[model samples]
Target: MQASTLAALKELALQCARSAGELSLKRMKEPFTVEYKTSASDLVTAVDKEVEKHVISMILKRFPDHGILGEESTFAQDPAQFETLWVIDPIDGTTNYVHQQINFSVSIAVYHKGEGLVGVVYDPSRDELFYAVKGEGAYLNDRPLHLDRIVSLEEALLCTSVFWNKRAEQMGIDLIVKKLAGKVRGMRLLGSAALEMAYVAAGRLDGYVSLSLNAWDFGAGRILVEEAGGRVTTMTGTPLPYNEKSSVMACNPTFYEELQQYLHVAENTQTD
Candidate 1:
């Protein structure tokens, strides 16, 4: 993609994100209906649907030829059918939005021919916008983010998620958590993989590892992290295609190698 095209997409994505975020904030405190998806713990809210509808409508109107893939709605215009695709997660941290009324975000990214060209993640609660174009450096609220260059796994701070079937998957993650718990400065579970990746790009967290996130969950944040001088791959350190659902490990270059070694072990031990 040309720099100009990327710039335009970035601007449009940012505007859409802010608009969706504002809508989220306005309705966050209201009595909203919540529903369950695959499982009870896996949640969806009226706001999630409404926000996604607003974003998709805007994108479709602006770029009629572009395809959209969103969490609330089924994928339209399969990736193989289009050169340009917009992946959106209108409410990334829906559980947080429902309970704590915080920490959620609006994530958007444009991919051309399967390569990410633009990315944006907006946290309305904090009013922080994290964005990047393919070659351009990433930014947190307009300030360039400098990825950590030192390889100090022991000193790093890691973030991860606990799945709905917490007990079933605990062993693998527990091993890694125990091994790194004493070594790393700290560990956190912020409940949103996209926000975690954005945090990694912003240098607020050293790395983020999670199992089984869909394309919409990490699509945008993946580009942002890579643009900020970080790396993202499966837990086993394999390259990821936007179409595949897999365990994700994203971190600055400094800690990627060491983190990969541990994550690879966890990945191998998982039976399901």
Candidate 2:
């Protein structure tokens, strides 16, 4: 895509993210209805749907030809076949939003084929807006962001999550964490994939080990990490899959392969 077009899209994404985030944040301070999607721990709120609708309307109005692949609703645009496709997670950490009233975020990414063209992850709690466009550097609000220098597993601070709805998946991820916890500087479970990835991009975390995330969950943060000089890929070290749930290890290239080796083993051992 042309630089101008990409910039426009970035601006559009930023606006939509900020709008959605503001909507959620405003409603967050008030009482709202919650419902379970897969499990009691796996949740969604009325605000999640409301904010998604707002975001969808904004995108459709501005770029109707564009296709949408959102968490709350599915649209008919094939990203692989179209010039532009938006993958959105209006509430990337609904549990956090519902429980703590913080740590959640609004995430959006526009892609062509499988390549990210524009990405935005907004944390309304902190008023932090992280965004990047293809060929452009990553940003944390107004400042440029970059990952930390390479560190060994022992010195690295790694992040991971346990799936609330999938016990076997949690067992696998928990086992990996149990094995690695003593080796890393520390481990963190922030409850928000987008925030965790933003932390990786900003050098707050050395790496992230994710299992069973949908395209909407990590799409925006993937490009942000890459543009900040980190790498995001599947457990086997290939590029992220566009239209599926997959495991990911996102960090700088230095220890990616080594990290993936362990994740690959964990994936195999963790079964339903």
Best by TM-score: 1
Candidate 1 segments exceeding 4 Å error: 74-80, 149-151, 162-173, 267-272
lDDT of 1 by residue, 1-272 (tens): 66677777888899899999999999987889999998877899999999988998888788888888888874555656778989899999899999887788899989998898888999999999999888888999999987956858888888877444364256657656567667888888888778889999988898887767888889989999999999998777777677556677889898788877765666666532
lDDT of 2 by residue, 1-272 (tens): 77777878998999999999989989987889999998788898899998988998999998888888888874545555556789999999999998888899999999986778888999999999999887787999969987658677778888887534365345566666567777778888899998899888888888997666888888888999999989898765667876667777788667776777766766555431
- Model 2 clash pairs? none
lDDT score at residue 183, model 1, on the 0-100 scale: 80
lDDT of the candidates, in the order given: 0.83, 0.82
C-alpha lDDT of residue 231 in model 1: 92
The regions of model 2 sitting more than 4 angstroms off are 74-81, 163-173, 267-272
Task: Assess every candidate by TM-score.
Answer: 0.93, 0.92
What is the C-alpha local distance difference test score of candidate 1? 0.83
